[model samples]
Target chain A: MSVLLEARGVCRSFGGLDVTRDVNFKLVSGDRVALIGPNGAGKTTLVNLITGDIAPSRGQFWMGDDDITGLSIPERVRRGLVRTFQTTRLFANLTVADNVALAIMQRKRISRRIFSSATELPEVKAEWSEILAHLGLDHLAYRKVIELAYGQQRLIELAIGLALHPKVLLLDEPAAGVPHDEAPKILDAINRLPADIAVLMIEHDMDLVFKFARRVLVLAAGRLIFEGSPADVTADHEVRRAYLGSYADARHSA
Target chain B: MSDITMIHAPQKRVPFAQEAAGALTILALGAVGYFLYPDDLAFLTRLIGIAFLVLSLDLVTGYCGVATLGHAAQFGVGAYAAGIACIRGVTDPVALLGVGLVAGTIMGLISGALITRFRGLPQLVLSIAVGQLVAGLANKLSWLTGGSDGLSGIEPGKVFGVFGFDMYSRTGYLFSLAVLVITFVVLQRFVRSPFGLMCRGIKDDDLRAKMIGVSIYPRLVAMYGVAGAVAGIGGALTAISTGVVGLDSVSFERSAEVLVMLVLGGAGHLWGALAGTVIFMIFEHVVAAANPFHWMTMVGLLLILIVVFAPRGLIAPVMSLWTKMTRKGKAA
Candidate 1:
């Protein structure tokens, strides 16, 4: 598989303490990878670096053949690399449809003429409706984002990422704070996305991670500990020691 | 016709009808004011000019979430530009207006670069500094601006060679009102546009706006330029209407007063600026007729009340009240 995004020797530090140390990673097109790590294992920091939220202390990143290490977050998004925050970041006061519409609007070439009714534009409205429906959020299209439940907000965040029509989606803890029942739904949605779009999910739930991701990368203390198929990673002794411990054993017995 | 089609037809027509009615009422009012209040025309002219000035503040403060107390500096610069132009034998109103807009835009571009670098209280401080600098220049350049004595002998030419703007209140009122109405309509159109949405988005969340690919600085600079032009037009109107320009045009108190007018009506709402200006000026007229000190006290009290009770400014509360009353009447 051709690499869609490649990170070589990615390093970031906060006041002498290394948060992400020489983390080399590659996401090929159509890859569904789960990054699993204990708390403070620098999963978010790595995502931030890849998404251009923060510049790497030292390293290089490429999207396809283009080096994107110095690009801003929005510029990266425009280039088809989009990410969801660990916590949902939404335009709270705007309607759910408006949130998605804004994302669609940014992609358009028109210099937003102030007096023209953007909503009446056929292409813009059609795209907005399509994105809303795809996210199963059409019914709540006009609802304020802040009024939505936590699960709904998560879906809205996913919708925002989807609206960007990204080539690679970096989801920072998609299953975090999701109820058990709703967790499977989110995983199912991610599983059903177009094969051309790569998904790199950071998940703590082993069951969901193993089920959703074909491959898994485990991080411990900001360094890669294991990289293999979900089954192989599940069976690794050090991965068990770092994250699973008795939980992996308990699942095995069950 | 089908019930759905029949029901929706009027829904589409209602906005147009309301707009037509509003236009008629405004025109009627203007006509009545033109004929009946000839004595108070000069004061009315000043009110319209001040309204234009406050509208500039609304563009930055209300729409873009830029808090500036230095807009008066732009007004002062425009006034000085027009006053200087008049002294240099450029008395045509349109030419003076152009000069004011150019001067204001240049100053705005300069100040906007400085202001856009900082936000919140820091932005406010920088704006105040800009205002002080402009006022000091006006004071120091006594020969050009006439310093404390102020620029005099500003003979604005005949309006389209038909009406001469004399010491009489009639011509001044109509000219100022015409400018105010045109500016208001242009601003209304501009604010309701997609560009306005971008500004609103920036105001709502700067970080998110940047994330959405909006370069905040360029947009802010452009907005400042537009705002400066509007303010300059206002300053030109002030110069033409009053036939004089002074350092007080850029005074800190003038900035504060315009800010108060914005806050009083509703900062974000376009019509609110006009409403605030009219209400404020009328209140001043009434209270000053009683006692000048009493008017200031009343205005201060009113501003304090507005800040405490209607933090979103007077529009939101008035709108809520209007909606509630209408709903209640319908229920009854």
Candidate 2:
């Protein structure tokens, strides 16, 4: 698999304090990578840099051969680099199907068609309906997103990401607020994602991380400390000191 | 195929039904006005003209979530363009509207470029400034625009080379009513379009919209241009029907008043814009005539009540009622 996205020594700072320091990584197609870090490890900030939400003070990002450090958020998205929010960020007032349909229309570049209803467009309707149905969200298709439960809304977020047809999908804590029972559904949805897409998920749940990610990258105090298999992450001294403290120790004894 | 997608696709039906309902309401309203205010066709025509302005405002502030207080800038520019075109011998009504539409689009693009760069209160302030700036220029270019005295001496030819624009304003009223209905129908299609849905998405949350891979800035600027085009038509209609373009046409008060009307009727939905215009203008006319000295007080009271009760505007309650009734009927 070829590298689909690469971050080369990326750095960012707010005032005098560094938020992300010299972050570097490569995401190849079909890679399942999880980025784990403590509260201010700049995990989200790093994702922001990659997504062009904020400009990196140093280093560059590339999609294959194209340097994308200066591309706008939407430009990156159009190029198939897409992300989901840690907290669910959806078009709350619009219907679930419309929320997904908007992304599909954008991908198809027909969002500018002003003479026809978006939902009635055969191509757009087909895509959103298939996505919603695939995610088992067909029942919530016509309902306003706000009317759905929090866990359901997160699933909608995933449904939208899939609709964007992303080659590199960045999911920021897809299971953050989900109830325990509802989390497996999120994981199942994530697992069902197209096999060829590279997914970089930031999750605090180690159990989830082990199950979902084949490889994991750990961050501590704005610096990457480890990058390896899920089993290797627990035994890394630096990652253990920085994040997995008690859990790592328990696993070590076991 | 899931039975739900094939069998229960009310989403496909809602826009057409709502659009049909809106068109019929506009026609019914025009008929009522034609019979009840036959002598006041001029006033009715004026109301229809302002309806265009409110609808255009809805496209921007209501749909795009761009807070603008200077929409009159587009309206005024369109009016002046049509008026000047008429004076320069572009006497055809349709041609004059075309002139207004182009002029409004350009003005909308210019203002939208400046306004869409910011968000929240700053956007509102920028819109007001743009409105003031346009009004100020109109005031300064007295030689070209006729300044405070207003641009006059406009004489539009027959609408289609047959129907004369009569002194009683019969042709003008009918022409405006037809245009309003057509514009409403087109706008109904517009707001339900993917472009319209995208704008609604931006309004709800810009970041989410961006992450979806849709560039919203140009979309918003384009939307403003569309809004300007609509407002311009309204402005042109006013110039053609009234046979004049005044400083008030582009004034800050005109912008504020239309915003008030939009809020009163509702902002996001096209119907609210029309409803707001009809209710506010008629209410203003009746109250001002009844208690000219304290008419502002009564208008204020009505606005307060609407805000307290139907915060979404007067149309919200009616729409909910209609939807509820339809669902109940379906259940039955």
Candidate 3:
């Protein structure tokens, strides 16, 4: 399979300390990967660099065959590379439906006229209903985003990403801050996404990662420590010490 | 997608009816003011001009979230352009209108670039600086602007060559009111359009707007141009009505006064600006008539009270009160 996204020797330094050091990463079409790392291990930094949020000191990044190293964030989004933040960034005042509709309306090919009345479009309304129903958010569609629960907000964020119909979706801790019971629903929704859409997620929860991700990449101190199947990753000594720690032993004991 | 699911669409749209009733009320008030207060017709004319000015400020500051304290400079530029055109024998209202729009657009583009580059206090300072610069230019160019004495020979041509602009102030008042209504209607449509929604989105979260494919800089420039054109028309109206153009039109205090009107009425809503202007003019006319300095103190107090009690402006409180009263009546 051809690579959907590739980052080569991506290096970023803040002051004297390296945040992301010579990280070479790739996402194949349909690949589901989890980026696991300790806090301040440059997980978010890597995502930011890939999404063109911040420039790398020295490296090259590409989406499909296009060199997107210098593209603006919006331009990158237009090119089918989209990302969600760790913290849900939603238009809190707008209704849930409007929030999702905004994404569908912003598609590069959509006519400016469509933006004015996207809800009136059959395809747009269908897409909105389908996404909301799939996430069990149909009842809350008309509610303001601020009125929704934290977990519901995360689902809405995912629905917004899904609305973009992105070929590649970068989710920065989609399950973060979600309640224990609601996390499963979000993870299941993510796992069931069509195979044509690639997902690269940063997750702190090991059980959710093991169940959903096909492969895992481990980062420590801004460097990739390991990349392999969940079974191999859990057994790796370095991975054990750096990331899994007691969690790996707990899983083994279970 | 079941046909049986019947989404409860209201039989008659409530907002439309409310809007229609509001329009009727405004027309009735305008009629009353026209008939009952013929001697106070100058106040009504001033109200129209100030309303238009407030609307322009609302476009940039309220709609686009571009903090501008120098819109009066654009208004002044429009006034000067039209005033100069009138002095040079281009007395046709249509021609003067075009001149004002063009001139305002040019100045708006220049100042917009400077203001959009910085944000918050810096943007505010830059706008203030632009207003000061325009005021200074108007002051120094005595040959063109007449300095402190102002330009006096501005005799605007008749509207469409049929109706003459009489000295009774009725023709000018009616003309300005007509212009204000047309401008407001057009702006209302524009504000409710997709472009306007995008601007609101930009104002809410610029980073998100950019991430979603909105180019902020270009949008700001376009909005600035639109606002300048509106302000320019307002300036032209003032020139034609007052029969003169003065340096005070572009002064910082004038710009600040418009900002106050926007804040007092409501920032984002279309009618809020017009309401703010009317309230401001009324307060100034009644209060200032009693004592020259008392008007400023009263305005200051009103602003502080509005900011403290109704940060969303006077409109939101009025809306809440209306809703409560309606609910109470329904219960009764």
* Top candidate, metric DockQ: 2
In terms of docking quality, how is candidate 1 classified? acceptable
Clashing pairs in 3: none
Give the per-residue lDDT of model 2 (tens digit) for A1-254: 79999999988999989988898899999999999987768898998899999999899999999999999998999999999999999998788988999999998989899998887688888888899998889988887888889999999999999999999999999999999999999999999999999999999999999999999999888899899999998888888798656456557888
User: How many residue pairs clash (N, CA or C atoms closer than 3 angstroms) in each of the candidate models, in the order given?
Assistant: 4, 1, 0
lDDT agreement with native, every candidate: 0.79, 0.90, 0.80
Q: Could you report the DockQ of all the candidates, in the order they appear?
A: 0.34, 0.58, 0.34
Q: In terms of TM-score, how similar is model 1 to the real structure?
A: 0.88
Candidate closer to the true structure by lDDT (higher is better), 1 or 2:
2
Error of 2 at A69 (Å): 1.2
Per-residue alpha-carbon lDDT of candidate 2 for residues B1-332, written as tens digits (9 for 90 to 100):
11112212366445477668778988998999899989889988999999999999999999988888999999999999999999999999999999999999999999999999999899999999999999999989998899989899999999889988887888999999988888888898888889998999999899999999888789999999999999999999999999999999988889999999999988888888999999999999999999999999999999999999888898777777766666678789
A65-164: candidate 1 lDDT, tens digit per residue: 8999988877887888888877887776556766676777776744367555444345766887887787777898766777788888888888877877
Displacement of residue B19 (Cα, Å) in model 2 is 3.9
lDDT of 3 by residue, B1-332 (tens): 11101111111235344345545656777888899999988778878877878998898898888898888988999999999999999998778877887888888888888898888999999999998999999999999988988988899888899767776678788888777766766675566445665676677777766666667887788788888888888888888878899878988889999999999998877767888898888988999999896789988998899899878878766665655565577679
What interface-residue Cα RMSD does candidate 1 give after superposition?
A: 6.0
lDDT of 3 by residue, A1-254 (tens): 98989988999999989999899889999999999987667999998898888999999998877889999988888877888878988876556776676677777345244123334345666788899999999998766777789999999888878888888899999999999989989988898787887899999888988988899999987899899998798788897787655455557778
Candidate 1 residue lDDT tens string, B1-332: 01111111112224344334434545566677778877877887888778878889898888799989988988888888998898789888878888998998888888888887789999999999999999999998998999988998898888887788877767877777766666666676676455665676678677666555556788888888888888988888888779899888999999998999998988877767777887898888888899976789988888888889877676666656655564577579
